[model samples]
Target: MFQIFTSFFIIYGSKGGCPMTITKKLVPVIIACCLLFSLFLPSVQAQAAAKFSDVDPQRYGWAMDAISFMTDRGILNGYPDNTFKPGNSLTKAEFTAMLYRLFDKYRPNMQEEDADLRLAGYADVPETHWAHKEITAIYDYYFGGIAFAFKEGVEEPFFQPEKKLTRLELAQIMYMAIPFADDAPGASCQVIMGMTDIPYELFSSYEEADEYRFDGRYSEDTGISVDYYVSEGAPVLYPLVLVKESDGSCSSSFDDYSSIIESAVASMHTSGIMTADDSGYFRPHAPVSRAEAVTILNRTYNYLKANRNLQQYSSLETSSAAAGTPVTNPQPEPPAGKPSSTVNPAGNVKTFTRDLAVEGELETMIDTEGYRSITVSIEAKEKVDVIVQLGGKKSFIRHEELPQTIALNGIKQVSLETQKRVFDLLNRDADYTAVLTVELK
Candidate 1:
């Protein structure tokens, strides 16, 4: 069993029920402390502006820390548009390539052996892929190839390079693949603890709050965690905090690792994922992103759902009906039908005329009032299937997966549930355009 970094966080228990908790105020003491911590870091605007000392684990996920550590050290970038798809699963080859970049510090000065597919290897992965070089190298070191006595003479060294990397597996692989990962500052690997080889200087204290530094450079002007906020009444907020592996939850503070989490969360707000509420409390520990970071972004674009009930909100405000909205209505699943030869077959497609609006369940919705409500439909040709997504303006509410059949005539459907509040926009450049991932068997 591996004792990796704990994932349990407790960001909210009290003012409960904000899908996302956006921070609005600043603790002066924390602000002052944040300033001093900045002094020790290398002076660079990007680095100074962004550092790991900040992370609201509740709002952001462990990836935020990974991202921050990579970014401050000058690595890993979001799209040219400046968005990080944290939840997308990466392939073994892709990750092996990333490992190469991340561990540039080691400058291993090794070259990749040409992908020798004649040896034992996964049938799906081939040398043609971009990560072929890195993937092959990793197999030689980390995951030894499958050994079968019957084919020993004929079997090639198998590299399951095309496998999808799991989050836990990725963590474990990254644990040792950090190139020449050294202890932070005064850390010495002479000792060992739950995290890995102990860095005596870094781990002298077990509490994150005590061990992490906070300088006054930090400001209240950072991103929020929860993606939405109520227009009136109480401000919907989610707290971001971390805990050891044993703890069950939180909506408020944590015993350790708050500073790093606070910094990471703040940075993630800039990167996206955790948006803000109208009131503002970056509920950093209110668990938001899950599985992979790419999916976190994909959810927003793909109407990718948390797949959990809306009850997860600290404030169970998912009671309002979205039937009044032009875009929402309970849509029964379309009956199975024969292929409409005129149209390409779609994994899923929904077609409706412009004036007709389909129904959907929105965990939450945001309306600017300025723009007229536009009804959009998802269509597909007979050749492929797609996943259509629609969203609300204020909340991170989604009208997920309205598959459409491919054709001149296509059917796209979405399920909406709640009409909620207004949320501050994080990325002005966020791609709001409907996305379609096509898979044809």
Candidate 2:
């Protein structure tokens, strides 16, 4: 009918850039084509939308945009039954597949065979595994340069693909996937510590916990507390927090992996790629769910798209060494005519004295170039623990009394030393200060 042909032309002719004029001779052909298209339009739209039946808008309103963006682009797929098990724990293999698919969507030139070849070096990811190609591609593309050894002292390298991914692990992977800026600033340990929201119920002693709680008031077990050092409206730093020891020394809940995990979580949070739950908890050790993974990936993609100049991990030049391993480079001498404390011309030794006010912690980075030995003298009002990390080596200066001295030899740089937990119980605003004297010889 003429009406039907007119409706089809109005809907598709203008948009498709076809001639708008209708001719009597071509009407029969056009009508047949439009009839065929009408039969398939609803199915085509349904396939393109890819909406999951279980993803109710009311329950998953926060993740609706992310889910739609990923699924519509074919970056994520639901089960055969059309349900997305959003709450189920995501395995490492699943996460890897998702990441690889996302990368492929953006960088289509990457070949699957080349990615598969990269995984030949791994021990666990067999050729027949369902996600072997994806796992190989992600690992080789992002972490190829970093050395891997089994933490249990085994020589074989293993990729436990079936293991459930944890929040901390996800943060670390996301952090590594993006290349760091050349002038990226170092993350502060204190800031990372403050971002961790610890549940108040976990504290062993209520009397001891009263000092850190807000207004000295105890709430329900479900209540959480962000440490006093964290500013209001600041992002949560890490999912894990430092545990207070009975001996008054604070130790990381992550133990040996504490520093790296804290740094990764802090970087992700600061970059707006990952965040905490409604209760202000990162839940670092908890298993990452499918919905959370996609949401985070969506955020990462958006961030990368916004910052067009930033380079991805796949574009970086990698070496055999670990990602953060410090490389010693030649340094230029300090400019002449600069003031130095007690400079000796014969030995070229200079002593620098600084008085630092320690609230939560104080971090200092000292260049140890053109020097043989360095000595640090500390004088504090109260007992404090000074942690010195240089060239991957950590030394401690626990001031049981006061006025202690420590010496370092053959060090290219002293990266960070933090003086922690000098609480002024009587006056909260008071500063517990320390005097640090560094002598470079």
Candidate 3:
């Protein structure tokens, strides 16, 4: 275990009775005091103009930033009473409208009303509903492939437009919809609980949050342990926070849906997209208010916009539903019917050398079963961290492992989920050249 930094952001303030204390032993008290001093500075007033009485800029500074970002973009606004009810539960209809607003702002072409929307087929959401257009555009037209909100039934699909959105649902939806920067890789070996020669990457002594476990830790027959690389001067023990991992039992706090919501909660917490309560516990079952939802969306939109790249890799099967993956044209299905010849046909193996963008994706999609093999080779300039998706499964890879060949065995489908591509770049304008080859047998 390495001495990794804790994920929680310390709260500092004296407004609305917000806590001015640090209970977590790992959090340095000096840091909290510095934050307290910064709150009263004159420069912060501009950022604190969130205008919401309920959200104190000194206490919940991040909330203010989120609100300001959204309002400035004309995507969100305060209530008529001049109060942002940050704690009020958000309804499904409202969330849809918020997402549509973002879509309208970014994709101006989607602003027109496509009166021929096929949402009338949904049993619950009728065309006459107030949010029908917004819902149809995002749920039916934009995110039809992912369909995270749809509940399938025997007769037809249903959208619970009136139901309140929960924290778990919000986290899962945001993770699926927005692209976030990946955490930097930490040093491999460090001291864990004063134990020397301990590896940080692989840990078995205890779990951090049960719902979120990365590949760094694993279990052995003798006992649980960690595996990590040995880097000079890196922290040994990574901070492991307490999460629901002891028992697999579901909690009513999640309204009897704990099992399904657990992973999303952990992912959000770990990714810094969502934070825990004062007690450091993520209330997975709590309802997400409209203000909070807008804040999340605002943050997500900014992240996506900042990371957009003009260079993209196509021909690879990529999922439109993947977070932050731009969707323009729908994927065309392969022509029906197998090849007239029963022979196993070989595909054209072509090699091309091009500049790969830092945030770009290299994808290949195969619609014919005749192609059974794919080999890709690249001479990467840097250690680029990328995710490879085959069928529906995903695996993390680095550019260091390139100049290698990948053979698809007993694999019939390939789809790359478009999340953020992590790369070790020297600068913003940096581009790496990779030689790729694709062959089918």
Q: Estimate each model's TM-score.
A: 0.26, 0.45, 0.42
Tens-digit lDDT track of model 2 for 101-133:
776542321432333223344566678999877
Question: Between candidates 1 and 3, which one is better according to lDDT?
Answer: 3
RMSD of 1: 27.3
Task: Note the residue pairs that clash in candidate 2.
Answer: 195-237
Lowest summed lDDT across 10 adjacent residues in model 2 is found at 321-330
Winning candidate number (lDDT): 2
lDDT of 1 by residue, 172-197 (tens): 34322321111211111111111221
Q: How close is candidate 1 to the true structure, as a TM-score?
A: 0.26
Candidate that beats the other on TM-score, 1 or 3, i.e. the better one: 3
Candidate 3 C-alpha lDDT tens digits along 1-441: 011212232243334656454446636655664576667664432444546667666655656656665565556667887776766788877887777676553221143243222333456678899987776555422232123223223344456678676665576565444433221111001111122221112322233233233334322321111211112232233333222212221111111122113334443554455766545555455678765786676545544443442112112112232222222212222222322111123445544444444212333334335455654444555444344445333344444454445567766543321111221221454455554444445
- lDDT on C-alpha atoms for all candidate structures: 0.29, 0.50, 0.42
User: What is the Å distance of residue 418 in model 3 from its true position?
Assistant: 13
Ordered list by TM-score, greatest first: 2, 3, 1
